[model samples]
Target: MDEVEIVVAHAERATLRVGDVFLKVDVDRARAEAEAEAMALVPVPTPRILWHRPPVLAVAALPGATLGRLGGPVTGSPTAWAAAGAAIRQLHDAPLPSRTGRAGRSVAEVVAELDRECAALVAEGILPADLVARNRRVAETALRPWTPAFTHGDLQIAHLFLDGDRVTGIIDWSEAGRGDPLYDLATFTLGHEEHLGDVLAGYGPGRDVDLDVIRAWWSLRSLVAIRWLATHGFDPHAPGCEVDVLRARM
Candidate 1:
């Protein structure tokens, strides 16, 4: 008999593991639809879809462990990280999907939201005002316009599965869409800046990537995500956590 294990449970979503199948239950049907659609469009390896019902999606478990966890040391080799980068490059180069719902934000909208979130962080006294302000300034570099590409909007390290030096699968496509390519790169390398060179090497040459903008996105993303994590009962202030990532920017 397959015993069910709760993988993650939060207000917005929950995931369960039963034997070889992983079940994702989302509060938002649109998000579930987008995830399914994105997974179908990406050229890279992804979990095989088993079935779907409204609000619930099931996929077969992929082989191997996650690439790494946030705020923790990455156990995967540099070769694996490079392979993940190449996979991302392939995804970005693929034809744009038509049903990219709510995929990206305008520069002005992003800046405005950043300001709002920064104020909340200050008011709540969750982070130092100076640190927030400095990072906010750094985030300005990412506000300029650029050519868009197919992006896994939330490409965190833990979402990638690896087997040896190869990328076995990428998961959690709820935020996939047509967006800034650097955002995906920045998200993947967040808190793991040491592996950026490996990723870039596999991402290949001739592609102009602005390091400053990537760093800025790192700052902006961490600052914006602090409250959400806290509200969801997750710690952002732990060692090497999002808060630490922001302070490290100094």
Candidate 2:
């Protein structure tokens, strides 16, 4: 690549690509350290770490396109989707890392935050009150007790890379930790609900999972993310994005 490419950028952090190297610049050194640690522990494909200094971590680029972005069309096949799911399961099943509280948010904290966001979404006229309320109710199913696992707290499609039918990489370990497994699954298949079956198939049937809880997390995540995405210079209202995810519930 002749020109430097910005993978993603915001106030808190930014990721830039120079040729085959990816430079992740963060505001918090601790979070960057934790990301490197999590990637080292997880039993999955990850970019090779080049070096890390405070507020910046460098890694070699993985050779594959991402499965899909929030507002993008599906690029990976059903088999590739299944491979991504299988890779997620492997990561989740692995032993929880020693330094694993990057997010450290409790379920009660999540519920409280969701409630606050929902109220604001309606009161500020960001979204219809009925839409907010209906999804809020739908999001409740995920509030029940759950076993914490080694979860990629933000397992969206952008973090997942696929090559043919194989999961080439799972990147962005900043959010990996001991968290609700369903939350990760829900996040991975958030807007891409159509391929959920393929994911479930590869996630395996040995473990019992509640479909309602996954649906609940869908609402909960989309509700809480609207304001942040908007403020971060992202168009959450764009087609096939967060707003579309919320609208699907109604």
Candidate 3:
């Protein structure tokens, strides 16, 4: 091929050729801001272009493999789930950067953000606008005594990398933040209960788990997930799916 046709996919904030000068993008600025507060995460195969003007990251190309080809239940493996949990624990315990500013706003602030997002979603006729109100009471009740820990913000199978039963890497630090650690767990467990069990087992009993809070997050998270799926032409119906199950529960 004389020239490669590259499609910059979802959640990619910035992209550049290996030798091309980088231009600042909002994603790059956010990554820079987060790097000061967090330990550098484990490296993955994605090509990272480091020496551009504003600095751009080019993800390492996937090697003739796709998630669809990986087959089933890699996520349900306890060893894999546990390994993922351990990686997150390491991230949570990493020292706060001196240059890092104050932590993200309170859970209340997160709730407010959710409220605003829900309104926007509804206004656009994207999702059931009342979803926020339906779960707001539970979310508020669940927030009491909420303990904050490092959160991967978005954690799931697609964001993880595995070799058989081992977790070789966790991809996509784009949404990493300091928040309720259980939120990550809830994110993991939403549809995959067995994997959730394995992750918890690996994390051990020392983790303070509040099932109620997880339930609340599951409901809220699923609502958000559904909206995203709608935006991207993905099926809402499938077995062993958390979003569908959670919506039913809601």
Clashing residue pair totals per candidate (backbone < 3 A): 0, 0, 3
* Model 1: residues with Cα > 4 Å off, grouped in runs: 101-103
In candidate 3, which residue ranges exceed 4 Å CA deviation? 1-28, 32-55, 59-76, 97-104, 118-133, 224-245
Residue 202 of model 2, lDDT score: 85
lDDT of 3: 0.53
TM-score of each: 0.97, 0.96, 0.68
Candidate order, lDDT descending: 1, 2, 3
Candidate that scores best on lDDT: 1
Q: What value of lDDT does candidate 2 attain over all alpha carbons?
A: 0.87
Pairwise lDDT winner, candidates 1 and 3:
1
Better of 2 and 3 by TM-score: 2
Q: Rate the local accuracy (lDDT) of all candidates.
A: 0.88, 0.87, 0.53
lDDT of 3 by residue, 18-127 (tens): 33222224355667445322325323222243432333433443322212211134434567667666665665555433332222346666677667756766788754
Tens-place lDDT per residue, model 2, 32-119, is: 8889998888899999999998888999999888877888887877888888889888987898776545234677798889989998
Candidate 1 local lDDT, 44-117, one digit each (tens): 99999999997999999999988778888788777888898899899889898775433267887787889999
- Rank all candidate structures by their TM-score, best first, as comma-separated numbers: 1, 2, 3
